[model samples]
Target: MSSPNELPPAIFLDPWLTAEGDGLKALSQTIAERVERQISSNLSQSARRDAISRRGLVVENLVANLAIMHLSPHLENRDLLAVATAKTKATRYDREDYPKRLLSGVVLAMEELGLLIRHPYAFRERSTTVAPTPDFAATIDRQRVKLSDIGRALGAETIWLNARTGEISFADRTPLKCRIEYQDTEETILLRDQMERINAYLNQSGFRFDGEHQGPVCLRRMFLLRSLSDPHSFNLSGRLFGGWWQELRSDRRHRITIGGERITDLDFQGAFCQLMYVHLTGKPFPGDPYAIEGLEDHRGGAKLAMLTLLSRRGDLKRLSPELKAALPRGWTAKRLMDAFTRHHPALRDAIGKDYGVELMATESRIMVELLLTLKARGIGAMPLHDGVQCAASSGGLVAEAMQEVTERVLSVALPVVEKPVVGQEWGYKEAA
Candidate 1:
C-alpha cells in the first residue's frame, strides 16, 4: 500500500472489454472474489458472498448501460476506460486502496490482451485528447453492441443504441449529435439513466426533431434534457450548458416547433443577479437588474459582470485582452464591477464570498420542482437554465410553475422574461 501523499499507480483502461480478451465473465468472477474477501462477518461466507455477488453484477450492468446509452459515442473506448480507472478524491489514501483494488487487476489483464491504452499522463483528459490511428483504434461500434448485450443480460430493457451505428435514438443515429466531448468521469456515467429516461419521455410525449431548419435538425437539435451538471458548482438546473441548443444560432432557435406549432423561448431577465439580490436583501431586485446607474450604455457588461460574480468564488481581474476584444468599448471588467457595485451595494459586497454554491443548490432545487410539476401536468417543458418552455398556449402554466417554485424556495418572485413566437408579438417586455 502507498502512503497518503503518494499518487496511485497509473492504470491503462479499456471500457469496452473484448470478448476474446479480458472478457466480462472473467471480470465478473474477479469482482465477485474481491468483494467476497471484503466481507468480514463469520456468518456463512459462501452464502453472503453469493448475495453480494448478485448486487455487484447489478452495478456492473449499470456501468455498461451508461456506456451504451448515455456516454458519448463519439469518444474513443479508451477515454471511457479512463473514467473508470481515474484516481480517487477521498483523503484516506494512507490506509485504503479502494480505487486501485477495484481496477488495477482488470487494467493489467486488459493490457496483456492488447486491448488497453494508457493515457499519456497520469491524470484523465477533460476532452477527447486521443486521436488513435485506424491500426490502433478498436471498433467502438462493435464494443458498444457487446456492452449493450451485457446490459441486456443484466435486465436493462431499453434499446437506445443502433446496432450498427452505436448512436442513441434521440439523435436518430446522426453522427456527432450525441457525442459527449467532455471528459469521462463517474458523474458522467451516473447521469446516463436520467438522460435516457428523459429522452424516452420526450419521444413518447410527441417531441420530435423538426427537420425544416437549414442545419441538420438533429445537430441543430433542441434537446430538452438536463445535463444535471454545471461548472458553477455542478447544479442540476436543466441548464443548456452542454446541449446542442447552446450551440444553436440565436436567429434560428425560433424555428424549433413541436407538433407543427412554433415554439418560443422564455427567458428570465437578469436571472442570477435577481436571485442573488432577492436572496441577500429579502426584497425584489430594483427594476432592470442588468442596468447599472452609471453603466447604462454597458448593460451587456453589467449583466456579464453580475453573472461572473454570482457564478464563481474569486476575485475579478481587469478584463483580459481576449475578453476586452469581445466586448464593446467602456465594458472592461473593472468598469463593469464598479457599475455593479454602485447599482447594488449590498449584493456587490457579497460577491465572491463563497455564496455561489448555495445559490446554485437553491436554483437546482427550484428547477427540479418546476420540471416535476410540469411533467405531472403532462405538459412537456424544456428547461433554459432560469426558465422553461412549452407551447405558447401552455405558457401560463409554465410561468405559474416557475413562479410557484421560485416563491416557495426563495420567498420572492423575480420577473420572468418571455420571448414571443416568431411572427407574433406576445413576449414579456425586455428589461430596459
Candidate 2:
C-alpha cells in the first residue's frame, strides 16, 4: 500500500493543486514582504486597510474562478464566488481577516497568471437601493422592480431583486467583474439548438418555465424518484469507483479515506450531470443531485424505460395504446437520458466514454448531438445519466415517466449476472 505522503497518479492532472501550489508560494512571498514593510514603516490604518482590501480582492477573484471551474454550466460568476467563499470559510484556515477577501486576492493573482478565466458577472455592480420603506401601504406606489426585470437586464437567471430598492442580490455572491470570453464553436451552437428543443418539449407537456425555481419544475422530486429506484448505491467513496478516487483525495473540502478508498460529499458526478442538463436545456437544476445520501427501494424501472423509449426516433409508433396514454405528450428519449444522467454516475461515464471526456469541445458535441436526436423526435426527455430519468410536468407525469425509463434502461444496461446454485451444506463455491 502507498503511504499518505505518496502522491496518487491523478495528482499530476489536478488543476486545483497546480494552481493553489503556485498561488500559495507567491502569496507567502508577497505577504512576507508586505508585513516586513508595514513593520519597518509603521503604516497608517488607512494604508493597512488598503493593503488588506487589495489582497482581499485578489483572493476573492481566485476563489471565484475556482468556483466557476468546479460549478460549470449552472453556476454564474457571482454565485461561484459566493459558494467558494462559504466553502473556504468552513475550512481550518486562519480567521484574522475576512477569508472571502483573502481568497479573492488569491483568485486575482491566479487570473493574472492566466491560470483561470475571470468571470465578467463576478465584478458587475448590482443596482443600488436608495432607501427603505416602512410598510406595504407606504411602498405601494414606490415602483418596486420585479426580480425578472433585474435578471433579464443582467442576463442572469438566478438573482434576488429587492422590490423597494431595486438592488439585485446574487445567490452565489461576489462583487468582482472580469471580462472573459466563452469561445463559441460549432458545439456551442449545437447545444443551443438542443436547448431550444428541450424547451419546446416542456412547453408541449404543459410545463411552463418557472424562473423562480432556477431549474426545471419538479426536478428535485424526479431526482428523488431516480435515487430511490437505483439498485446500485451511488458511493461517493473512491474504492467502488477507481478513476474518481484520486480526484477526491486532492480536494481540500472533503477528506478521502487514509487508504485512498473513500470520499464524502464530493458531488462532481452530479455536478457534471446538471452541467449537461443545463447545456442541453438552458435551465438550471432545482437542487444539487449530490446532496442525496443513502438509498431507498421502490422500483421506477418502468418510468426509466419510458424515458429511453422517448429518446429514440420512430419509437413513439412502437408504443401500445395503453403505454401511449400513460406517457406525457411530447415526451422523447433524449430528454429522458438527459434527466437520468443528472444524478446517475454510470450514465455520465457512459456518455463520457461515447464522446471522449474533454469538457470543452468533444463532450459538448456529444451532448449536443444527443440532444438533437431528442429534438428531432419531438420527445421531452431531459438530459440525465444512464440509470435515471426525469421531466417537467404539472402532476404525477414526472414520477411516472421516471419510473418507466429506469426499468427500460436497467434491463438493457444491467443484465442478470447468474451465480451457480451452491449445495446447501457447502461453505465455498468455485466458478464453473
Could you give candidate 1's per-residue lDDT for residues 200-286 as a string of tens digits? 444344332343311111111112212223222233222323233444455555655555555656666667777777777886777
Clash count, predicted structure 1: 0
TM-score of each: 0.51, 0.22
Error of 1 at 149 (Å): 17
lDDT of 2 by residue, 1-432 (tens): 223223111111111211123333344345334433433335698987776555543433233233222322232222212223324332211223333444444544444443333332222332111111123112211322121111101111111111112232353221222111233457434534444554445334321112211112111000000122233221111110111222222223122121121211111123243333444454334554433222112113334232333222232234344433444555444543454454454435334231112222322233334334444544343333221112212113322332233233222111111111122122222111
Task: Record all residue pairs in model 1 with backbone atoms less than 3 Å apart, i.e. clashing.
Answer: none
What are the RMSD figures for all models against the true structure? Answer: 13.8, 23.1
Best candidate according to TM-score = 1
